[model samples]
Target chain A: MRAEALLLFFSFSIGIVTGDWNILSYTTKKRDHHQHHAGISLKNYCESWRINVELNNIRGFDVVPGECVGYIGKYMTSTQYKVDVQRAAEQTTLFLTNNFRLGADGKDAWIFDIDDTLLSTVPYFKKHQHGAVLGCRGATTNSTSMEQWMEERSAPAVEHMLDLYHEIRARGLKIFLISSRREHLRDATIDNLVKVGYLGWTDLILRCAEDCYHAVANYKTEKRRKLIEQGYHLWGIMGDQWCSLVGHPSANRTFKLPNPMKKAL
Target chain B: MRAEALLLFFSFSIGIVTGDWNILSYTTKKRDHHQHHAGISLKNYCESWRINVELNNIRGFDVVPGECVGYIGKYMTSTQYKVDVQRAAEQTTLFLTNNFRLGADGKDAWIFDIDDTLLSTVPYFKKHQHGAVLGCRGATTNSTSMEQWMEERSAPAVEHMLDLYHEIRARGLKIFLISSRREHLRDATIDNLVKVGYLGWTDLILRCAEDCYHAVANYKTEKRRKLIEQGYHLWGIMGDQWCSLVGHPSANRTFKLPNPMKKAL
Candidate 1:
């Protein structure tokens, strides 16, 4: 591996991910991207993604990934995934319309994060319950299956997000889809989004090889910050991770979709 | 101090001032911001800022205020301060007019660093030969004096940067003056800049108390990124130090005025 990549990856060996020298804190290992819920079982864990599978129709398990959190209780299949996202989207749309002023040009846009926010990765996760750590951070794992799954271009769309996608486009705002997926996945990713009926997007951005070692938040913020610099008003940003929501050039507002499937702290 | 502030200060003590996290490898301690030339005697090393008193039409003995470096050669009269900066400004003007396209609305801007770039603190550094290693990094040493100097706002212009500032503005682009100076000094900084004949800036940003501990590069870059997000195209950024030029949302090109005044390795 390249020296920079080595530094980026192994730097985590230092306990203080907050170590200023290692670059931004890649410090939080298992916690970097997703959260591990209490009772997450293999099927229940979403890894680093947000999944919305209706467990026995109690809505969805609203469960955690990897370890077993528990049997679905009255915990509101009312799942955080199901409840909050829809509300955030509705409120954001209303707020933007009531307050923002866009130029007559139809170029105003909203950004969407691909994996959990737009497409559901549940189907793939079901087929391979191996995305999580085997036991400790020392598991010997192979990603052949996951690569095949990504290459298959077959993830389905989240119903509500699809509705919001169309709603924002109909209002004459452009959509910019940015994903942390490697640049090589560009074709498959585009195919999947199109096959699932996503349209009118101004751009679909996949991470370049150089970005493989970057923190997810740094990578996303840099891109969004660039887009903002280039004269686009990022009306809103929709993502399943907090990393997506917290940085500068903040969207006029943001909507977070629950991706309990992924691990986040 | 706030916990975050302490973290910021302590982090700097790490040799990683060149810490990749900051993107700007703060290689030099006393050298981080400016460089003092060879043969700079204790009396000669007027460290904190650049003082061009013109001792030998070749400029006087330019010395250090912080740590020790080497001696001066034909360096003074050969002061890069006098030659390179002027040439850089002329060349930059040529580059911008030939390559960039400005929006009719006049939102394009060039960011300028206040100290050493727009105004020289040579006046203040002359009195405080005590600006460097006072003992503990805990409390600031000469800030009362530094703050007083700031309040006085008598630092003179770097001359060439000022010319470039007006040139860019005349081309229909706005000017942005951003400094790593503390937030409390905002009024004095502005008053000083104006007192010294610097004007027409769209915004004058000073470091907030909260950001005093941030690495100089990170602080400046974040602000530039925000400006881009707000739809302003940063056409150029000129500062005496590399820290100012190396981050994201790069200006079309940057011009570095020679300020070999502070002590560097």
Candidate 2:
């Protein structure tokens, strides 16, 4: 009976060890998906619901050569609106610069996402109540002034946050802005980032025309890998979507701030 | 006074936010280093403190084309002796298989460090008195029974963890065993992994004589990039040292188990 008890005790110990392993593994797997998505993408994904950009015909918008304007509409145009696109952009910048280690080590870099992250072009479609507003005949072609639109459609950067960005550049970190805005929106997006006090960056990376075929995360990862290969240790990354941080381990220590206009995306 | 109160509140909030970001970034950075070194080179680095292998002279040893053995002395060797190496190997395996989503869906793969991770050759070293006996003039020159020299040198799979691997493989996940072990030791290491139930991996990446210049983490990252180019998403990675997981984001999620033999390099 003693011998049997010893054997039983050993077996029970093994069972406990193995059981712990399985539980830990399951918990970890669940956490991987959770952490990868976090809450950052939830708001963005919901906002995407209002965006009816044809996944296949993203190019038809004449994004290049044609001037584009961003508008924040005060309407519930889609079932997926979670945050107002304008407020989301302000909160993203404030949260990232204030919370992350930006402009450190004299290596200036900034990673940004296009779409609702940087511009609120979603308004053009909502005003027309459709996804293909730009492609529609007779759509207004003249782009609105970014400064005026920012004041009218979005909240300006909080005073302290703008000051913080100035402080970042004063430290000598060369800033690089990365985005998935597509090559066509490059000129307008750069103009917007500059008008909004993001003029310190050294370079801006926009998504190539071919990037439409890849997942947003994959595109961001490849861009980040290229940046690292070019010998830059990015100090900060900001995006309204989790996809922006996919390949950036250096900037994984991120910050998420509340988007006050949580219903108008 | 009202202005002062508001200023104070904002300052306090900014302080808290900045402090939290710093702590998170530091913790993740440290974890990155830990995950980078959790493999064969970690063991080799530890071993280097005792035996220096001249990379240039490794070819000289290859000229003999026979069995080579290294023996480590008693448990109490020097101040560098650590009792945690053995425990770390077991724990690392458990942590890796549990936390990372490692299944085929072509979404992830693992690069394992061989030596201490999959096999404990320290027992053989101890039996041979830290390679002193084996290093003696005119040691056996042909293939010797690795299992026979030291009974403890046998590579034993962490039993409960096999299910995790089987699960990974069943889901189509690829596994690669990377080692800094000499090219001559390849067959022995492979045989050990097979005997210990770690057979049927996607690839076994080893350090060639010409590939010694780069740090282990750099080497692993380059290899991982190639795998990624091949369309594999690296969701999980494991190593016993800081250099093995350097370039991958998953390295931040590495687990460090207790090392039973804390040999230092």
Q: Give each model's clash number.
A: 38, 44
- RMSD to truth, every model: 22.7, 22.7
Candidate 1 interface RMSD, angstroms, 1 decimal: 28.4
Model 1 residue A32 lDDT score: 37
Off by over 4 Å in 1: A1-65, A69-80, A130-143, B1-265
Candidate 1, residues B1-265, lDDT tens digits: the string is 2323423433342223221111112234232332212221222232112212110001112243334222221122222233334445655776686677878866788888777677876456545542321111111555576677778777877645666677677788888887767778888888878886678889888776776776667778888998988888888887755456655667766655544443211
Q: TM-score of model 2 relative to the true fold?
A: 0.32
Q: Candidate 2's C-alpha lDDT? A: 0.40
| Model 1: DockQ vs. true structure | 0.02
- Give the per-residue lDDT of model 2 (tens digit) for B169-245: 66566777766554565676677677766767988886657655555556667777777778777655654333444
| Per-candidate TM-score, chain A | 0.66, 0.45
* Cα lDDT tens digits for candidate 1, A154-178: 9887645676788788777888998
For residue B95, give model 2's deviation from the true position in Å. Answer: 19
Task: Evaluate all candidate structures by whole-model CA lDDT and list the values in order.
Answer: 0.53, 0.40
